[model samples]
Every structure is written in C-alpha cells, then in structure tokens.
Target: MQFENTREFARQLDKEDKLSRYRHEFIFPKVNGKEVIYFVGNSLGLQPRSAKKYVDEIMKDWAELAVEGHFYADKPWWDYHERFSEKLAKVVGANPSEVTVMNTLTVNLHLLMVSFYRPSGKRYKIICEEKAFPSDQYMINSQVRFHGYDPEDAIVEIKRREGENNFRTEDILQKIQEVGEECALLLIGGVNYYTGQVFDMETITKAGHDVGAFVGWDLAHAAGNIELKLSEWNVDFAAWCSYKYMNSGPGNASGCFINKKYHNKKDIPRFEGWWGHNKERRFLMEPEFHPEPTADAWQISNAPILALAPYLASLEMFDEVGMPALIQKRNKIVAYLEYVLQEIDKDVESTFEIITPAEQEDRGTQLSVFLHGEGRELFNYLMEQGVITDWREPNVIRLAPAPFYCSFEDMYEFGQILKKGILSKQKV
Candidate 1:
C-alpha cells in the first residue's frame, strides 16, 4: 500500500481502522497538555481504563469477606489464576490446559530450566542467541554454573556476522545443526528485544527436537505483538511478562506455556508449591504432593491476585479484539510508518538506518533505528517535543506502533516530529 506523509492520509486510514476504538481503552501520558504519541508498548504498556475497576473489585472483596474471600469473593481468590487460562492460551496459541498464569518472567524461566535443561552424559551445551536480554544471559550463565560447568564451554552463542544488524535464519539453523550432538537445550527470544526480529519457532523447535534437545522461548516481545504457536510448534516450555506487549500494568504477573505432551509426565522435575497440587486434594494438605495434570503443575506459589488484576483487564481486551485483528492493523500502520521513515531518509539524507528486518513476517510492531551522527541529541529533542519512544545505548531509538492503542495519526505525527528533531539537530 502506498503511504503519504500527510495528516489527511493518516486520518483516512484511522477512519478505516476497525481497531481504532481500542485507542480509547488506554490512558495516554500527557505532554504540554496534550497526549503524547505512545510507542513504547514493547517496554511498559499503557494502563487500561478498566484496570482500576478490576483492582477495586478485588480490594472490595478483601474488605467485605476478609480471609473468607478466598472462597467467597465474586471471583474466588482460590481459583483466581484459572480465570486467565483460556484467554491467554489464545494470545500465545496453546490449549488452556497447557497455559498457566503465574510468577514473573525470569523466575518462570528458572523453574522451567529445572525440568527442561537437564544436561546428561555428552549433551550439556545450551544454544542461544548472542546478546540476549541481560536477565536471560544472567540466568543461563548462573544455571550453567549451578550445575558445575564452565559457561564458556556449556553455552553456545549464535553471533551475527560482522556489521550485521540481525541474525540470519539459515545461520541460526546451521549453528543448531553444528552443535546438535552436544546441545541439550535451545533457548532464544521469540522476538529479539533490540532488533525486533521474530524467530521461526516452529522450524527451530523441530530442529531442536530432531537433534535431541529441548526448545523454549522468552516471549517478552512476542506474546501479544505477533503470532505464536507454542503448542503446534511443540515447544517444551515458554514464559513471558505481561507488562510489555500484553498491556498489563508494570511488574504485572506473567504467563507460562508447557506443551500438553509434558502435562501428564509426572516424572519430569519442577519446582512445586501448594497451588500446583491437585485441586481436589489441596484442602487435604496431604504430605504426598499430587500435582495438577497441566501446566499449573509448574507453579511454586499461590497466585498474586492484586498484581494479576490489571492483566485480566488487558486480557479481556485482547479476547475481544483478538490477535488476528490486531496483527492486521499492525501490518498496515507499520507499513505506513516505514514508508514515512524512508521518505525522511531520502529527503534529509538520514544519519541513521533501520536495523529491524524489512520483511513483515520477520518483524512485529517495532523498528529499531540505529542513529549514526547526532542520534542521541535528536532522540532527546523528540522527547522534548512529546513524541514518546524508547532510547537504547549506542544510539538506537525504538519506535513501536502498537495496534491496540496507537493510531495512524500518531505515526504521521511521529514522522513530522522526527523530521523536526533531525532539522533541529542540524541547526545545533
């Protein structure tokens, strides 16, 4: 679709957008008495208007029922996490029995590693992308150390070729095949945080399984931004935070997916708690633990209902609009933004380059622009001008046009503001 860098064009597109109504669902941040163009859903999502109502209901239950709220509340605290299973399963493409809402992302990763990362005999090495999010790197590094192995020898990083911005799928597959004999697990980000490249999980999962390795993903950026098929891909396990693309509040509870293939495998190891115990026998408080025959079996503690309420509010919205609708708007708006950016690059002789993949299937909502000269200054100027985006070190600015809340008008404005920032930097 041809895109024009005009407010009229953007307004026309917005008028045609079926998802335009969703923009009103979120509370936008104010800048100079106007709402800023919020494009940071890949980091912290904007608060849903219904979030307060959800939390207030929970709080009211606690006030009226006190300890009895566990059983007596409108939505029982005892089974609060269960409410999210079916809706969340749709977002990540898994069965309700295969998905569970619980702990933070990194914590879930550690717990899953206990069962999936078992290194035996000659198969001990873990394959992951180089420069994964720091938390994942730290977790892998510490896990390898905990098992009494040198990280340098136990971890295999697939690095990009010199000066390349993203990993090539062929290179990644070749790396997997190269270390297939020694690799025990293949853990990678479903959508890379920096480059915004969406990995081919189905193929990668198949490659890992064929090579006798377990495969998993960190879906922090992938969960709500792009399509996921953890169940169909036969992924062994996966985890993601709700705060990012899921549009849950900051530090909100996360979701986990464990393929049903492992649900009935009682012999598999995992960290356990009372919440994971069989519901019928939970009240018995028996010494012998009978785990839930589902992904809930991985839970190590009771659900944090207050922290989870906001996520429920967000998930309801996701359920209404669905991923297919969201992905449709995402493609059109992102294409418009890309067109605008290319126009800017041509007209201004841009000092920056977009590091994200050009293919729609290979990327999601974000475009990572690696600014060369005056990048930081231009970023600060845009911030001052009320264009909300994220800045990473080494001169990259990430702009994500979230389909749920962001509008085509916002993208047009971003292009205008970005051009102004560039010109202002030149004058400086």
Candidate 2:
C-alpha cells in the first residue's frame, strides 16, 4: 500500500475494508470539530454509540423495578451476571464456566492470588518482568509480603540484556530454568504495557509447570487485543480489564479465567464470598462454603451489572467477527503500521526507534516508539495537532491499531503525523 499522504491513503483503505462499517458504531472524539486520527485504543478504546442505551437498561431496571428487578426483567436481574457470561467466554476462548465477569483488574488479581499463589518454605519466590504494569508490581509485592516474606527477597524480576529494550525468548526461558526450583508462581503480563511485546505463553506455562510452580498471567493489555486460549494453554489462572481494546467504558467490569484443571478442586484455598457459593443452594445460606464447580466459583460478590453493559455490547461484536479472524486482521493492520513507521524512521535515521518487536506474532495491535533525545516534545506536538496516540513515561509513544475498529489508514495517518511533526521542527 503506497501513499502520497495519510488522508488519501486512509480513504482508499477504508473503502476496501470489510470492517469499515464498525467505525460508525463508535463515538469518536472531535478535535476542533474534526475527527482526530484515534490510534490509542491500547490505552482507552472509543465508546460504542449504543453504550448509552445499554447503560439505560440497567438504570431503568434499578429505577422501575427496584427490589423486584433482581428476579424480574427480560434478562433477569437475579441472573444478571450471566447475561454476558457466554459472550465473554467466547471472546477469551473459554468454556462458559471457565470464565466469569467480576471485580476491577487489581482486585481480581488479588482474588486469583488468594486461590493460586500458595507459597511454602522451599518454593516461595515469585517471577515477573522487571517493568510490569505498576499495579501488578504492587499486587505481587503485597502478596509476597502478605505471605510473611520480604518482597526484595521473595520476588524476582526478569530484565532484558543490558542494552536491549526488550526481552529475548531465550533470556526468559533461561531465567525460568535458573530460578525454577525456588519459584512458587510465574506471573507475567499477556502483553507488556510499555514495550507492547507479547511473550510466548505456552512455553512459559510449560516451564513453570516443569518445576512444580503455579503459572498465571495478567491480560490487562492482551485479553481483547490478542487471541488466547487460557484453557488450552493450561494457564492456572488469569485476569483482564475490558476497557482498552474491549471498548468497555472507563472503570468497567473485569473478567477472569481458571482452567478446568482446578475447577473441581474443593480443597483449593480461596477468599470465598456469597456469590461464589454453589448456585443451586446459594439462597439457603448454609454455613459451609460449597463453591460452584466452574470459574464462577471464584466470584466473591455479584457483579456491577450497569458497569458490565458496555462490555456485553462490545463482546457481542467480537463474537460476530471471531477472535482468530480479528487477530489475523490485527496482524496485517499492524504490519502495515510497522512498515510505515520503519519507513519514516529511516527518513529520520537515528531520531527514533521502534521498541516493539518487528515480528507480527510477537505483538498485538500496539507499537511502542521510543524517541531518541526529545520524545516528550515530539509526543506533545503530535497531541496538539490531534494525533491521538498515548505517551508513556520518559520518551515512548504507544499506538494501537485496534483490529475490530482501527483501520489501516488510521495507522498510516499516525505515522505521517509523527513524520510531519518531526519535519516541522526543522523549519522552527
């Protein structure tokens, strides 16, 4: 795809896209009354226009039906949490029972830790990336300390080679081999928030198991952006937020998974609540905590139905497109984006670097561009001009071409914005 300028290229690509109609379903923000090129879905996805109506139903249920709403209504408020369960399962490649919607991301991460991270004398250390999402760092550190151990000693962080911006597969595998005997849990991001790098989950999961450790992942960035099979991967457990690529509203509900392998384990220690009690006799309120046999068994309380509505609406669209097909679309779109970014980087020579992997399979929709000497200035200039990409700390700009809605031309335009933004500096 050759282009004279981003606008013309975008129009042509949109015309050829099978998913072009999806753009109309979303509410894009206006910059000076014009639609800005939105490429930051990796940070916060655009809201669906239908979200208002979806949210209104919950408001109406609470207002009109009041107490009776729980057992009444078309979808039934009593089973309201189940409304999006099946669709949520389809999005993450899980059995209906293997997935459940509940809690915020960090809260769910803690709950999963309660059930999965059982530390002991010889095998009590935790393994995670050095630059994990800050919340994850806090979550793991707290867990390590909660188990009566010092975080600095109990927690181990894997870093890239001294001068490298990303971790090599062999580096991660070697770290696991080196620490496997002492590791109690291997917790990692499904996709690194800062680098936009996707790690090999299957191999990591296998290695963790080889040394008798529980393996879990935080899919905050990867869940809706990438294709995954948590159950097939034998991942002991995982959790993710839906607001980013899922297009759920800000602070929306999160979803989690437990491989069927642990579903029947009644002895698995947990921080159980009423909602997680056996569904059939939950109303009986017996003293014994007889848990549900599925992932629903992990739920600590009823979900925020209103907060989950937009996620339901978004997951329905994913169901229509299917994850595999969406991933295929994502790979091609980002490759086009990457190709253009490289072209521009070549034009500027050493001014910037693509910190994300060059290979398609090693990332989702996101690309992290590190500016050489003045990243924040370049990023702010792009933002002022209405090129909507995200800026991480120090010197990196993160752009995600969400496959369900982001277009090839949108990716093209972001590159052009960066290129033009840099060239404008020469005239200044």
User: What is candidate 1's lDDT per residue for 1-428, written digit by digit as tens?
Assistant: 77888999999999999999989989998989999998899999999999999999999999999999999999999999999999999999999999998989999999999999999989999999999999999999999999999999999999999999899888989999999779999999999999899999899889999899999999999999999988889899999999988878888887999989888687898888999999888999899889999899888788999998899999999999999999999989888988888877775656668899999999999999887775577777888888888999988989898999999999888888888777766776
Global lDDT of each candidate: 0.91, 0.84
Clashing pairs in 1: none
Encode model 2's per-residue lDDT on 36-150: one tens digit a residue.
7788887788998888888888888888998777778655665677766677777777788888889989999999999888888789999999979999999999999899999
TM-score of 1: 0.99
Best by lDDT: 1
TM-score of each: 0.99, 0.95
Candidate achieving the largest TM-score: 1
Judged by lDDT against the true structure, how good is candidate 1? 0.91
Off by over 4 Å in 2: 1-9, 346-350
